[model samples]
Target chain A: MNKRELFAQIQEKKSFLCVGLDPVMENIPKHLLKYEDPILEFNKQLIDATKDLCVAYKPNTAFYESMGWKGWRTLTETWKYIPENIFTIADAKRGDIGNTSAMYAETFFNREKSEMGFDAVTVAPYMGEDSVGPFLNYKDKWVILLALTSNSGHKDFQVLETGGQKLYETVINTSSGWATADQLMYVVGATRAEEFKQVRKLAPDHFLLVPGVGAQGGSLADVCEYGLNDSCGLLVNSSRGIIYAGKGEDFAERAREEALKLQQEMEQILLSAELI
Target chain B: MNKRELFAQIQEKKSFLCVGLDPVMENIPKHLLKYEDPILEFNKQLIDATKDLCVAYKPNTAFYESMGWKGWRTLTETWKYIPENIFTIADAKRGDIGNTSAMYAETFFNREKSEMGFDAVTVAPYMGEDSVGPFLNYKDKWVILLALTSNSGHKDFQVLETGGQKLYETVINTSSGWATADQLMYVVGATRAEEFKQVRKLAPDHFLLVPGVGAQGGSLADVCEYGLNDSCGLLVNSSRGIIYAGKGEDFAERAREEALKLQQEMEQILLSAELI
Candidate 1:
């Protein structure tokens, strides 16, 4: 899905929240495990409960990956459960040399021929041009490259200066030449709200996948104030804070409630900023 | 799969080579496609042919992830096929916030209860302390964090100055506090041969997962000159150059030949350095 359609979905649903599907077998309700595929069962219910209230559904690949074959089957099935209107992200932090990345592009973007049919993916640009360029080769698929992350180690390297600019800023500027704003996006962690102002200046039109909001103590107001673009171009993800809101049978219900709260606030922010 | 055992395997094999399992469907021999799982079949043959030649097997997770459910299945099955003595790596570059990263730690390192049993994993430390610390929490499992990448873009930020120190240096120095040399490793690209000398000073005893050896034109002699340590802690990876060596019915055999060439070179390096 393109940025315009993603924005429209947010406005129509009155939400900019992207609920993260970082499922843990232990954390999942015990009753749900009775199903043939417990993870898929849990994800289907989560999507059904919060689909209307959110603009995106991000399934972190590592969670499914930990489960091996069963986990992967559940991940694919869960991808089918989400509505077409809602943007789907294969939170697979994949980045490699160009020739290899081309196949990764074909794997996720080309559904009819390939297995992973996600609309977008999270990429690590540590490998440079060839690694990231292959993901951008897809026509409509989005490349959410890592910029300034939301973790404490982000201070280790991302903030370092390169030719008078921070490493993250340099990545933004250098990679901007490879793909346009339409196909490219940056993962600017919500916890680093202050850096978003500088990030916005580098790629003004590109979207930003903001994580670490509800659970990580990154204020929604702080992120919106500094990161939101001319379009409602921020996909704020909240995994533990929303999905595990309640561990009982009412888990999905409580998740929807938390997602609803975020969406309602996002609607106001969009309106106040004259983005919608 | 602790450091001591992994080192023993390298000594017994008389080889420090880590065969890269990056199976691309299009590149595989057509005869294998008739099987239920072509990738798995190709990998089984490749593993069978080279099991005695190499001490470790590193599977780039992106290749399996692109294949979806089947790809993930192939990866798990392939892991099972490898001999117990050989070190296994799930080359999934993962890093996120603290709480979320804790889940990643559980995903990769918790094998007693988890389906994906890997000896080590490649992690991105751009998120700082919290992101990297969780991965280090798992005892006996190695965390191969990104330090200096080999791609063309490595110049963009990895070598940048932060507070008068190179970004990679800062990562190597600071990350020492998170994990011991036994559990922590850094990805020092083979292309950055000269930089390996400096990297050794910061991380004298830690292993280095070196990529870009063959197809990327990184010299083996150059890498060994500056990168080797007392334990021969170097997992040199060659993806396309080995797996897609010939792309014909003899692909597996060709992969063995490519791997043998590297194993021979590593043997010489180890002998000269008196590591074995």
Candidate 2:
């Protein structure tokens, strides 16, 4: 999916919040464990509850992946559960050699496969274009390349100055040519609100998938103030802050409450920005 | 497994090869499709056939992830098929918030739900430390962070000069402090033969996971000459070039042949470096 359509969805729903699907086995309701696939069951209910309040579903691949086959199966089924209007993100930080990356593109975006149909994918920029370009090759597919992340270790390297500019700034400037904003987005951690101003200057038109809000303590207002563009080009993701909001059997309802809170805030932001 | 143990395995086998398990559904023998899971069947035979020939088995997550639930199961089963002596890698370039990353750590390294025991995992360094630190928290678990990539787009950012040093160099120099060489490694794409010398200077102690040596047109001898350290710290990976050497019924046999060829070359490099 391209940024234009994503914006339309946000306008239609009056929300910009992207619910993150980062299900933890133990964190899931005890009742789910009785089912053959607890992860899948939990994910289905979560999607059912919050799909209408959000414009996107960001499934952090590591969560399902850690479960091995069962987790992976859960992720696939979860992808199917998301509504058609809501964009799907395969939060798999995949970036590899060219041919290998091409297959990754096929795995996530190819319609022929039984796998989930993700509108966009989170890509690691470290491997450069060969790892990312293959994902971009698919028509209308979006690649959310990593730039300045919100993590504490982000200071370890992402903020390091190289030839005057920070490493992430260089990544943004250099990778702009691989694909257009229509097909390429970036993962700019929400906690790095200060850097978004600089990041916007680098890729003024591209979308930014911002994590680290809610549970991680990143300010939503600060992110909107600095990160949003004219098209509402930002997907703010909250995983633990959303999915694990309540540990009880009413987990989905609690999830909806958390999602509603974000959506309500996003609705106001979209209104002020005149995006809706 | 820790670096020392992984090295010991390499010494015992006299090979520095890390065979990539990137099984494509279409690439495997057609007969395997008749089974409940073609990808799993192919991976099982591949692991069984090549277990003794190499010291590490790196399963690129995208290949199995694309298969949806069935694909995930195949990855789990494949992980099970690999012997304990042979190090296994969940080649999933994962990085996210601290809480999310911690769960990812559990997913890949948690032995409690033991169907698969991967010794290490490939992580994207773009998110900085919080995204990477969780992976390192586990004792004996190794995080192979991306350093210099082999893709054409790699030139877009990884090689960009930042404060006189390239972006990738900064990632290596900065991330090295977060974890010891025993816990951290770097991905130096084999295709970037010219940059290995510089990468070695920055990360002399950390092992390098080198991809693009075969089908991607990278020179194995070139990377070995410049990238090899005193510890023979190189896990040269050949995915498509080795795994899909032939598409016929004897694909597994052909895969063994291709792997053997690379193993033979790696053995010579190890011997010449006096690592054994």
Candidate 3:
């Protein structure tokens, strides 16, 4: 989806919430164990509950990959389940050399080849332009490049100064030349709200996929305050916080409640900013 | 496999050559198309033919992922088909937050959970210590961190100076604190032959999984000149150059011939260095 279409969805929904469908088998409700693929069922119910409250659904590929080939089947099915109007992100942190990266692009963007195509893919920018270039080759498919992650290790190399600017800044600045904001977005952690200002300066028009809310102790208010643009360019993801909200058969209902709380807050934020 | 076992295998085989099993469906021989999974068949035959010739097999995960669920199964089966003595690397350049990265670790390293227990996995260092720490937690497993890649985009951020050291150098120096040479390795491309000299100084004992030696325009002799240590601390990878050597019914034999040439050259390199 393009920026205007995504913005229109956020405006109509009055929320920029992106529900994370990261289902762990052990964390799943016991009643789900009766199903052939418990995780897929868990994901479908979660999507059913929260699809209206969120603008996008982000499925981190690591969780599915952990279950082996069966998990991959679950992942593919999960993608098929999410509503097409809701932006879908295959949070597959993949990047490699140009040729290999083209295959990754084909994996996530070309549904004809990979059996699933996502609206956007989370890519690691360590390999630089050529690696990220292949993904941008897909028109309207987004490449959310990693920049200032919310994890504790963010200070390791990302915050280090390269020349006069920090590494993440260099990443944002250098990679901006490779693609316009229409095709590119940045993964800036909600945990580091302070970095959001610096992130905005470099990527003013680009949308930022914010993680680290809820379970990771990131303040949604703080992220919105510094990260939001006129278009409400933020897709704040909350995985463990919402999915594991309940352990009973009413798990989906509980997840909806949790998503409702976030969506309400996002609606308020949009109102206060006069974005809605 | 541990450091000692890997070195011993190189000495026993007299070849530190690592044959890359990155299969593409369009590239496979038409004769193998009769099988249920031609790619898996291609991989099995490649492993069967090169098991004795090369000490390692690095399957770049992108090619498998591009085929969707079937591709993931091919990856699992390919990992299972390789001989126990040969080092296996799921060249999945993956990294994320702590918990997510742990799932990736399970995806590639934990056989009980994922059914594909690879000895080593190529991890991206963009997310820092916590993202990479989980992979090191696995006993006898390896984390070959991306340091200096072989791609043209490697110069984008890797070569930039960060706090008196290049980004890739800082990556090496800081991540070295997370794991020892036994459990940790680095992906230093053979394309940048000069950078190998700098890499060896920081990591004298660590095994470097060197790609870009064949189709990527890297010379084995040049990589060995500056990158080699007493234990022959390098696994030179050649994917397209070796795998697609022939296209007919005798494709496996042609692959063997290509592998044999590299193995013979590696044996000579080992002999001249008196390491065999």
Runs in model 1 with CA error above 4 Å?
B245-252
Per DockQ, the best of the predicted structures is: 3
Residue-level lDDT tens digits of model 2 in A1-276: 666788888888898888888877778889889998888888889888988888888888777666666666677778887878889988877777677788788778985774567898888777676777788777888888888777677776677776778878877887887788999888888877887899999998988899889777899999999888999988888888888888899989999999999999999998998887
Candidate order by TM-score, decreasing, is 3, 1, 2
Candidate 2 chain A, which ten residues in sequence have the lowest lDDT sum? A64-73
Q: Best candidate per lDDT, number?
A: 3
Q: Which runs of model 2 end up more than 4 angstroms from their true locations? A: A31-36, B271-276
Q: What is candidate 1's DockQ?
A: 0.54
lDDT of candidate 1 at residue A27, scale 0 to 100: 93
lDDT of 2 by residue, B1-276 (tens): 777788888888888888888887767888888998788788777777677778888998777766666766778878887887887888877777677788778778886663666778888777777888888888888888887776776776677676767778888888888899998888888888988888888888889998888877899899989988877888888777777877878888988998888888888888898887
Ranking by DockQ: 3, 2, 1
Please tell me the interface RMSD, in Å, for model 3. Answer: 0.6
* Residue range A144-239, candidate 1, lDDT tens digits: 999988777677677777768888898899899889888888899888888888998998888899988977779999998988887877889999
In terms of lDDT, model 2 sits at 0.82
Candidate 2, residue A110: Cα displacement in angstroms equals 2.1
- Every candidate's DockQ is 0.54, 0.62, 0.93
> How high is each candidate's TM-score?
0.93, 0.91, 0.99
Clashing pairs in 1: A152-B128, A152-B129, A153-B127, A153-B128, A153-B129, A154-B127, A154-B128
Per-residue CA lDDT of model 3 for B148-224, tens digit only, reads 99999998999999877898998899988999999999999998998899999999988999999888889999999
